[model samples]
Target chain A: MPPPAKIRIDLNSAVPAYRQIVDAVRVLLVEGALPPGSELPSVRRLAMDLGVHFNTVGEAYRELAAEGWLDLRHGRGATVIARGSPAARPEQLQEFRTRLRSLVAQMRSEGVAPARIAAELRSLTESLKP
Target chain B: MNSALFLSLLVVAFTGAFMLLVPHFSSPRYLFAVTVPAGFRASEPGRAAIRRYHWWVVRAIAASAVIVATMAQSWPDLAVVLAMLPAIAGVASFLRERSKLQGYAAPPPGVREADLAPDGDHLPRWIALALVPLALPLAAAAYLRAHWSEIPERFPVHWGAAGEPNRWAGKTPAAVYGPLLSGAGMMLFLLLLGLAIFYGSRRAPQRTAILKILVACVYFLGFIFTGVGLMPVVRVPIAAFLVATFLFAAAVIAWGYKIVTDPAQPVEATLDQYWYLGSIYCNPQDPAIFVQKRIGFGYTINFGNRMSWLLLGSFLAGMLGLVRVAR
Candidate 1:
């Protein structure tokens, strides 16, 4: 039997709950942790788990479905769907670089060394490999 | 001894017994469930505090039993009031124990963590079909129907301290069928409410425990209500029914406490800061209308939720109906 799909969210995080849901699920999808045909818990169930509003989870599911990573149908809950790789667009790449730079700067401000940051970045890249 | 005095003694004994179980329920094993880090259950302060709590409650219950059997008969009403002393003392002991456990500086990692709730269809398929309880009341009604011809025209509605019938009612359909219908209605209402609580609650052993207790209590109600329903026909002593009901209630409560505090079953009960007045659980962020009680071994309504207000309204309505029936 396939392993259960899992996602973790921090309620205390600065990020909004719905955004956290999207980020967490998208990572799982990209990592193939959630394969096509995987059934995500219903909005009510996930909302209950996360201790968030039902609409928050519903919005996240809708956003994922819009991104081609999930298929949401009435009464079926959400199902992961197959998505072909699409190279990062120019705007998306720019956005990633901006976020990466901001994160690195924040890490450096927190007294992290440049060498540690580079190594951490390399480790994250390595982890993405199948 | 008068029946009222005997009944009061029984109430005191049952209360004492229930108080004894509270310490175990409030123990770290059930409170934190498996959510706390390994070995925290064995922590010196927590274990010591729990042991202290158990010792206090046990002693209180023992003393209470002695007092009820001997001293209570002298002034049963006063004894009934005095009964609250041990129960109150037990609660104070538990609160102190709770304080000692909370004195641990480090919070459990799982305290902040959340469990993935089972699919919204978390209730067992069979629970949704829990129409079994309805049959108890119906069986009672059926029995009454069978003896319809010979049923008494006047029966005791209320019994006084001397065991003599004080209030009498003629065997109209209302008097005959009222208790049965109302009992059946009450049973059905409780079952539906239980279903609501079962599904509205998140993942935790207490969730199942609450449902089981609810089911068990309903069956007990079936006995009480059916007995009361046949009051006109069954000339059995009112004291007998009251005694039996109280005994059954005590047993059910004890059984429920055991289920609630089972060490083998780890729970994912979340302790929130929103527990208003230290008893009512209130969490605005939680979509669940019900959550496991932090101070006790059962579910409490989240006053923060809008649905909780509706539940309170319905509960009040039910209580009013019960009051009318009692009258």
Candidate 2:
């Protein structure tokens, strides 16, 4: 097996600490670096490692649990779960649409051509396929 | 003039002298335990800074030694404490450099992620058995039994700084054997503590040094404890004891320093901000019970780990028990 991948976050980043942890763990989960049934570090341990409050890690773990990526127990701690994809919802797509529009606008402002933007999106979608 | 005074002077002198070498105990390029990019610590300007630091430490040690030699006969206890100034100065330099190095060097590469694994690095389990000989204080106790008739009805159990026996204990078996028994108990306690530290450390180099020091201490303490316990009976000269103790200390420090600071074993760290005031390490993610000191030369307990606390508590209790037995 490959060496275990690590989740890291910048304490000095503009994003909130909890959000950084949530995002980092989500990326690890998506990339399958943290396999299903693998245990997450206890909230207190992660908080101490990140120099953040216990609630920050607890909140992040709760967020991941709500998103169906983890199972949190009162005493046993958090564990990854084999999460199937959520059903497509138009409301979620609307949120994605707004996010994409802002991203595309930012790229355009940076002088990226519309054709180049569309090509990059097509490549990302292709790469996502198994 | 007395055993207590000699012991005090030796402790202070040894501690202060060891303090002089503390800064050089870590990797020069990396900011000691934090492992930040200390480009300046290895640069021309950094060389000047290090030179100045060393110059001050030398002065502190020299002054402390002079004072210790002079006042040890008078105010022995105070002289011992005063002798700690050099080591204190060394720590001051370490912290000063840590702070200054932060500004002069780039910020630390923060929040490192390490693969959590149990890697035992080929150390044999039999190495721990080196502590077995710490039980030698018992032999001294046995000798006291053979010469039981020679023991006076009332003997000097404790002494003052003026070379006079101050506290007397009845020559019962309990009083006769107390110090040696305490020595045996203390050695046993320290052996357990050392083994815990050896197994608790994750870094291979640190573990190697911890093993050497712990094993070395087992033998060193065996002799020291047996000698100390036998001192009142055998009437050993204070000066001779001091010289032997100093040699043992020098050997232990030299050997440990050589191993732990071996350029081969550089300790790595991350999220140093959690290292409260750059001293106390509170990393819960780290599995090791003992970690290399971020600023000093030896092992420090991980305050975040519950097991570290338990170890500390038990060791302290053992120490108190040893003292009670000696008293």
Candidate 3:
């Protein structure tokens, strides 16, 4: 059998651990790495593995569950669920555009060429395609 | 040669050799329990520390052998203390070396990895074998009750190196049943320890290896103490017991050495600052109650964790209860 999907987090990163966990799991979910019906480690187990407080993993799992991606049971651990693709709202699209523009501005400020940035954007978009 | 003196010398030699090999048992990323860069153990400073540590251990062993040989006949009780010289000296040298190597301590790895799947948490089926030894003490207890008339009014409970009874116990209920009860208690304690290591520590191959050793030890304790309890009604050879114990211990140490020295064994990345004296691990931020030991083959409790205090407290209470039952 193939090995289970893994997630890595940098404890020294500027982002909070819960945010990092949420972002990493979201990426895996979108990339089809964590398929529906897949089980996630228990909050306590994941917290121990990450060397973080139990509440941190719990919070991340709660966020994912709220996003319709996970089902958290009392005794059983978190499990991935098949989430329906919701129609994008205009406000959500605007928020995404703002974030993307800010990221592109930062990249240009760091001396990235416009052509290189466009190429990188095209590669990511291609990867996101079904 | 006096058997006591011979045993003392044997212990000294074994301890000396074991202590000398201690530096090689741990991961190469660690020197004297302090985390170092890969291949640092072959560095000039690392070689010097190991050489000096060995020098002190050898001296301690020679001194212990002379003491045990000269003092065993006159003061057999002190022979046990003499046997500890190598370990005491080895620890002192190890700490000194660790302090010097602190300058070269590598940065603790900041990234942590974990699989989303939670499948490996179940205990191995062979762990059920630990339950099998629980019956030995129970069976001995049953046999003792049935053969009560055969038990003597007084029997040897302790023996000297010459196989002579050093202490006797009256054939009261406590005296007859204490050893069996204590053995059962010890077996239970070891089983609990094995469970704790399986559940409390991070997933690693060494965890299962240590658990297997614990299961074996539970079996060894069950047989040894059952034989002790039956000594009043049966002729049990003290020498045979000693030889068996020696062989069992030798096997355990050899197996443990092989597992700990395996390069593929994953070593936990713990901050050096959290480890006091390079042995006692204390990290409040770590959620794990047990962490892998840098100095030994098994897991050690994180003293800084609150749950660890509860475990330690319970263990001490259990030990006290065992002592009471034995008395």
- lDDT per residue (tens digit) for residues B89-120 in model 1: 77788667655554453443232233322354
Runs of candidate 3 exceeding 4 Å displacement: A101-116, A128-130
TM-score of 2: 0.68
Q: Give the clashing pairs for model 1.
A: none
Query: Is model 3 an incorrect, acceptable, medium or high docking prediction?
Result: high
lDDT of 1 by residue, A63-99 (tens): 9999898889998888888888889899999999999
User: Candidate 1 — which residues are off by over 4 angstroms?
Assistant: A72-77, A98-130, B1-7, B27-82, B92-122, B160-164, B237-247, B262-266, B269-272
Q: Count the backbone clashes (under 3 Å) in each candidate.
A: 0, 0, 0
Q: Relative to the unseen true structure, what is the C-alpha lDDT of residue B263 in candidate 3, on a scale of 0 to 100?
A: 86
Instruction: Please tell me which model should have the higher DockQ, number 1 or number 2.
Output: 1
The TM-score values for the models, in the order shown, are: 0.80, 0.68, 0.95
Number of the predicted model whose DockQ against the real structure is largest: 3
Worst 10 residues of 3 chain A by lDDT: A121-130
Instruction: Encode model 3's per-residue lDDT on B293-316: one tens digit a residue.
Output: 888677899998999999999999
